[model samples]
Target: MAAAFLPPSLITVIWGFIGIVCPLFAKGPNKGIIQCCLMLTAACCWLFWLCCYMTQMNPLIGPNLSRHSILIIAKEWGNEITNTTTT
Candidate 1:
């Protein structure tokens, strides 16, 4: 597991490198599937990032969130940014 203290962007760079290398080593259908999964993951990460930005800019979208819930969301935002990997 990666140290939580590391910047999320660093993790993203590592994962992106791994994703690229994986497809290079893979063959045929496996390569295609891995690439597709990576693309889907990248998309979801982007969507998560967008949601976090919107929520931060406009808390009125969900005013009932407790402090703990807000913290959870913040952690998720970091995770999302770290999830991207190029395949």
Candidate 2:
């Protein structure tokens, strides 16, 4: 059910390909804009996922309760880490 809320594969694949190419290309304003836009879009996606998860998993329960939430959170956090580590 929540899968419906996910970003499309085309969007992801395009972003991934761009991500791979961006580094090889010279650093410039366009590259920075693309990077920023991608990160912003990813963050917004994670937030939407988190909201959907919370709605679906109301009264969350389990051993690593919130595991799904953690995954989403990690994705968001990872962007920050990668940006910092890479640049």
Candidate 3:
């Protein structure tokens, strides 16, 4: 959906600017090192943030039900199981 893609697009643009544009302004003998550091930092931050965002959108874990819990719930909630016979 447009909603899902929009946030990532916006964030990527921001990070792209930080990594690509900010490096151009670096000065002195350590300019290359600064640029590399900025780009790597941007990339790592983007990757980590994207991973967390996707995980929140689709969780990896879920609740599990066992036979004991099912029976307990059925009894406490007054639910009855029925048997059907077909001839």
Candidate 4:
């Protein structure tokens, strides 16, 4: 199955350009170092962004709401609180 998403693809392309393309145009004495730094930085930043995005898409934990708080929220939102259980 293929999941079509624009943000992730767009971000990857932008980072790919920065890491792979930008390095080729480096000049001066520290050209190699500059290229290495650019590639490494881009990879780290892209990985971090991807991780955060994936985490948000599928959160590890759900909200833990107390019965009282749930009731309050339900009443405020005009939603009926059917059952309240204590753990």
Candidate 5:
């Protein structure tokens, strides 16, 4: 069970490293854009890892919960807020 999460976690780490390295090599007017994209990607990767870590720790802290479900709920709530504010 624990082994299943390792691959995705490793992949996230790889992506984070890519995000960090990409901006350093970028040049010209697009450098800021590249850095912004990298920052956003890193932030998302960090959030994903945090959610997974929370889910893994749930067994010891509280009831077992699905990380996907939590993420879904958060997305829906964000969408709801955006929709309401746009009106």
Candidate 6:
């Protein structure tokens, strides 16, 4: 349960830190564009993760959502593809 939240949350924190630190080290004429792009990317990453988290928590959408279930499904799909293809 907790493990499911770690990846996206950690990524959001990392991006937030980058967004803050990038502007401080910015130099030259392209500095403004660089800072703006970094900040925009960070914002998008945060928002996307937030939406994912919210959807996972929503009872109406997925009452018993689990990261393990998703992983299992992905693993099964991979196995199916691997078995279908011959080398």
Q: How close is every model to the real structure, measured as TM-score?
A: 0.39, 0.36, 0.69, 0.69, 0.43, 0.53
Q: Candidate 5 on 1-87: residue-level lDDT in tens?
A: 989688677877787787887778878888899898887888787778777877786555665668666667778787422224334
Q: In terms of lDDT, which candidate is stronger, 2 or 3?
A: 3
Q: Model 2 over residues 19-45: C-alpha lDDT tens digits?
A: 555445636768777776666666576
Please state the error at residue 43 of candidate 3 in Å: 0.5
Mind giving the per-residue lDDT tens digits that candidate 4 earns over 28-68?
Answer: 99999999999999999999999999999889999999988
Cα misplacement distance, residue 4 of candidate 6 (Å): 8.5
Worst 10 residues of 3 by lDDT: 77-86
Q: lDDT per prediction? A: 0.62, 0.59, 0.90, 0.93, 0.74, 0.77
Residue-level lDDT tens digits of model 1 in 1-87? 455435456655655665555556656757788777766676566557557755775587555887667667878788423334579
Q: What is the RMSD, in Å, between candidate 2 and the native fold over all Cα?
A: 19.3
lDDT tens per residue, model 3, 2-76: 998999999999999999999999999999999999999999999999999999998989879986787778878
Please report the TM-score between candidate 5 and the true structure.
Answer: 0.43
* Clashing pairs for predicted structure model 2, backbone only: none
- Candidate 1: which pairs clash? none
Model 1 reaches what TM-score against the true structure?
0.39
- Candidate ordering by lDDT (highest first): 4, 3, 6, 5, 1, 2
10 residues in a row with least lDDT, candidate 2:
78-87
| Comparing 2 and 5 on TM-score, the stronger one | 5
**How many residue pairs collide in each prediction?**
0, 0, 0, 0, 0, 0
Cα lDDT for residue 45, candidate 1: 69
